[model samples]
Target: MRPIHPNAPGHGHSYSRSHIPVHDEAKAHLIASANHSRIVSIAAQKFRRRENVIARIRLVLRILSLLLCSGILIVLGQAVMVYYKHKDYVVKHNGTPDLRLWPRGLNMKPTLVMLGASVAATVASAVLGVASFSKAVRHITRVGNVVTVLFSTFCIAIWVAAAVYFKIDDFDKTKHYDFLSYTCARRHDQVLDNAVGNLGNLCAQMRASWWGALAESVVEIVSLATVVWAWWVGKRGGKYQKIGVEMLGSG
Candidate 1:
């Protein structure tokens, strides 16, 4: 074979170092991509954790609201029972105790209004609470949340109205009837005393129901705030994730 020249096809230049930089660049690129992927994964995990936390908080609030409203409903139900019992007693006795002698205890209209509100709130809370557990019904969950918020608002208004009416009615009845002072003199008459006692008990129940309504309204407002906070967090996280994905894709 002829002696190979320096610049020949299979000569001194056969072993080349130019490919080293390309290899290093490829390795660096892979490492950077892997790091980005890890960062995204961590972010996603954190976001899911936060989302779960919010969901749990909301569920708890919903249950609490449900319980509160249920309590209110029970109280109002007792009031209604006492109210009807008093009417039946008066009719059966042919007004022997003379209802006009006693202070009017609970106004029927306001009591009914509060009762209805409690029922609505309780039902809404139950439905929404159940929906929250189901990830497959996201649309329904969103709609339920909106309905709950609306009901909360309406409940608050009605609660306030009923409470104010009760307050005003109580004041008027107290001023006109003056039953507290009359109780001493009427104690000798068993029927009158029993009638007075029954009315007094009914009034107490009404007061309790109105107070419970106000408390439930406050809980509803808190629940609404949590819902809004959860929504904001989810929206913000989604925006950040989108931005991160865009950045990774460009890179």
Candidate 2:
């Protein structure tokens, strides 16, 4: 008969190792901590068991993160187009949207500022999601779960600010209603109704920007909730207590 070691995987029936018990006071505490953190990891892992609620939440968060990225792209792209379209238009002696005057420059544009924040948050979310998915990189996922709340909060604020401004200042009840459709509407039409080419086209671009910003904001909020909950389900004491006990029982 071959000698059987306690740690061997298939020796459960032959050289049973269930008799051992952890007697070291200090070692027990350390093993418990490691096992607790392991549960947290599985809760956030991409290929985790489907039955676990935390794993399911993490999966939803992954999808939302991807949508958030797309939304960021749409918002930024529309903003850029609208800014350029009205580059030459003026409102009450005020020049139109331009990047040169944005923050880091003496003059700053609120919409542009929001756009920048949204872009950064989107990138952070993407990296965070990727770290969670890869599993191969454990440390990155841990760090990401820790800080994602901050970035997601930033995204939510900026998005809501832009969306609110769009609804209140751009559209109205009737007649003067400028945004005819997403593809066409007058930007500051109350002021720039005179812009030379296809004012409706400008309107469409602006509408797209608003929708994109709003959509991402909602998605980020949900993602934040899910991530926090996931951490909660993973970190609770009991999840790892069994593992720690098992480890102790193994030898």
Candidate 3:
């Protein structure tokens, strides 16, 4: 008020000294706020990118799991078809069912039953497994695993029964049949006796060898292993989800 300078406030000044620092501080705060906003925007963008990548990975895994289940189902179906066809052939021909068709050394009927059951169970498991791959039904994996395990156990039991039967069926002295005319009058009786003897021996040998039973056991074991593998995969997927969450959080 004594002598107002040209640059002093309330005179012909641009700004007061006290206001200068305040303006500088305000500018600095604005710049800092802008910088913070930029950083936050960049971080958000990065987080979104990471989330997209994780989602893709999870989708791929789910597809792979579905494919695996489909493959298993196909295999089971084929096996069942072959078994039924062979069974039909034997029934039509009125011949003793070829024990060879039943896994290498198992009892015939038990093997057939086990294989049939396995096929049915495998189909059911595949359906459930596929359903589990869906985001909405992932919880079905546990049920699928249980069914698979049960099917495998049944297969093992079938093999065991076949083995027991094989132990009782004798192969040696088993008779062969020829539907042709015979020369000797006693040929018919001899042939018949031989056939009965051969069948008895074959049965005894089948009971003794235990090949069919072993086949069922092996198949069951594989089924059980598959179930275990599926369970592990599901667990791994759960871990991946946690990792994905952490990745997003960090981003």
Candidate 4:
């Protein structure tokens, strides 16, 4: 081996100039790799955060959906029961006493029609609301949620109005029957009085429908407000999701 100088250009103690370029390249590669890893980690974390938010929103929506369905079903069920009970009363008392003096009790067909409309609207609203939560169609979802909220509000309003009207009508009928019973009783007609009294008793029993109607109205109004709130929240969530998508795309 040759004896090398201490300041040799490419030998012994002197660093190779070529190695500096390689070292710089290695350092650049390492920095780029670290940047890529950091970006990936940040993206993953953001995705997870968005997913958690969406999951929480979905959970809240499901709970609201259940409550809405339950409330509507309960009101509808009670309306149906009242309809059947009234029908039975009318049929059973067809030939008894002087019920003809008073106006006939409520006709159930109109109530049925109202209930049918309300149920149909509510079902549509629920279906749309559920569909609106899909990320693939978030814009459509926003529109659908808006429409659903409107429909739900309309249905609730209709039901509340109908129930209030029905309650008022029931009160009127009750008053009429009471007067008839009192008049017949004062006339010293025992058989007629007994029949009228029994009929009045039936009317009194039906008074509970008024209370039920009021309760249903309150529930429906609250449900309407909740649906509106959900719609607003969903809209906000959709906006956030859109922002997230844009950020991801840009990144």
Candidate 5:
């Protein structure tokens, strides 16, 4: 006389309302977890791009810095060679590439002092580049950048002084009728037998020094600045943390 049970013999059994809801809730939780996990994964993937971009930029800057350092050496060497080749002719006339404008302080090779400074700066920059590639130590990069900045600044100052000292003489130019030929006359060595070679050598040195000071120096400064910027960005103190529902829940 009691109401027939659903599971009674020959009776078809259907899911109970309470049990059905339980299974539905379990399935819903699984789906939600999967969706949330995917979203988190996607977000993480996107955030990684920012780091990648910074790394790529840093690499490019390192390459450029290396090239600039090389330019400093190559250009300065060209200038030095020009002076060396023609200086013998000038030396006989008691002419020195002396820093006559400045009082003798170190008793060093006057014209070579600037070139030496450039070598030091370029070497320091090259060392920094190597260190950056080998190890990304934050303090090291900061210190390196400071050194590079100071050296590069000094380079600019010396470049200006050297430019004026090595300028072409106007009176001589009028006489020689050519810039290179005039610089040769300024050498004050009339005893040189090879007139053509003397003019060419003196003129070459003058132009090489001028171009090194003007073009290569500019690139070196820019390279130093870029290195500093890259280091600063690479050692960023702040990170952009993305707020997420999962993080909040976990908190």
Candidate 6:
């Protein structure tokens, strides 16, 4: 029998074309897709981590502000009450003395404004801080940041006014009384001491309240800074995402 060549016309079997190029092309495409997915996943993870860190920082700052603002509110409330009690004593002791002679700067209106502003700040910070933990609600953090900044600004203004004007002309100048006179028991007149029991303590309380207001302002400023930081980070992250998408599309 003659040898039958594989490529002979009568041959029933023949070699198919090699599929190496097509296989390699397909594999390359698959690898490219996987790499793109991996890159995107990594980028997403980094973004989430950064976001979480910012959120946590915001939460801490807000909590601090909440505590400080609440403390300020409490101090102011006590000071107002103590002043009224002293007034009551004066009225009972002196037989309806002139209201004009009372302390100059402890007006109830301003005190109430301070109290109301503090309460507003406290509630806003508390609500936003609690919302930071939820991924679903975290989307609203940016809005919360804006709201926080507004609240902080308002609170700072109010607190600064209160601190500066609190009991401005109430202390006795004859005894060398200065802004901090009552704070340290430097002024001890018999009348005020007799009318307001523990007069030194009341003065100290007022001083503390003013200092707390200042402290609250400081915290508010810091909180506002954090909000700005968050916005910057978010803007940067958006740019990174845009760049990443361009790179993937080009690939």
The TM-score leader among the candidates is 1
TM-score of 4: 0.40
Model 5: how far is 247 from its true place, Å? 5.9
Q: Show where candidate 6 strays beyond 4 Å.
A: 1-20, 88-116, 123-141, 167-195
Clashing pairs in 4: none
For model 5, residues 89-196, the per-residue Cα lDDT tens digits are 422225645322112231224345546645665676566566555434212355545655565566566666655544533334443433333444555544443432
Scored by lDDT, model 1 comes in at 0.63
> Number of clashes in model 3?
28
TM accuracy, model 3? 0.35
1 or 5, greater by lDDT: 1
Ten residues in sequence with the least summed lDDT for candidate 6: 175-184
Relative to the true structure, how large is the alpha-carbon lDDT of every model?
A: 0.63, 0.54, 0.44, 0.49, 0.51, 0.64
lDDT of 2 at 87: 52
Query: What lDDT tens digits, residue by residue, belong to model 2 across residues 14-116?
Result: 5333443445645766776677567646544532442255444655665676675566566556756654555555444446453221112211143455466
Tell me the tens digit of each residue's lDDT in model 3 across 151-236. Answer: 55754664466345423323322321111111111233433334233333333332222343354456456656655555555555
lDDT string for model 4 (70-175, tens) is: 4545555564564354433321255675343223553554345445644664575466557656653223245544554565466566656755554443356454
Angstrom error at residue 65, model 6:
1.9
lDDT of 4 at 138: 26
- How many steric overlaps are in each model, in order? 0, 7, 28, 0, 0, 0
lDDT of 2 at 66: 64
lDDT of 6 at 247: 62
* Candidate number achieving the greatest lDDT relative to the actual structure: 6
Instruction: Kindly give the stretch of ten consecutive residues in candidate 2 with the minimal lDDT sum.
Output: 99-108
Stretches off by above 4 angstroms in model 5 are 1-47, 81-110, 135-240, 245-247
Model 3: which ten-residue window has the lowest total lDDT?
176-185
lDDT of 3 at 109: 45
Q: What are the TM-scores, per candidate, against the unseen true structure?
A: 0.68, 0.48, 0.35, 0.40, 0.46, 0.67
Of the pair 3 and 6, which is ahead by TM-score? 6
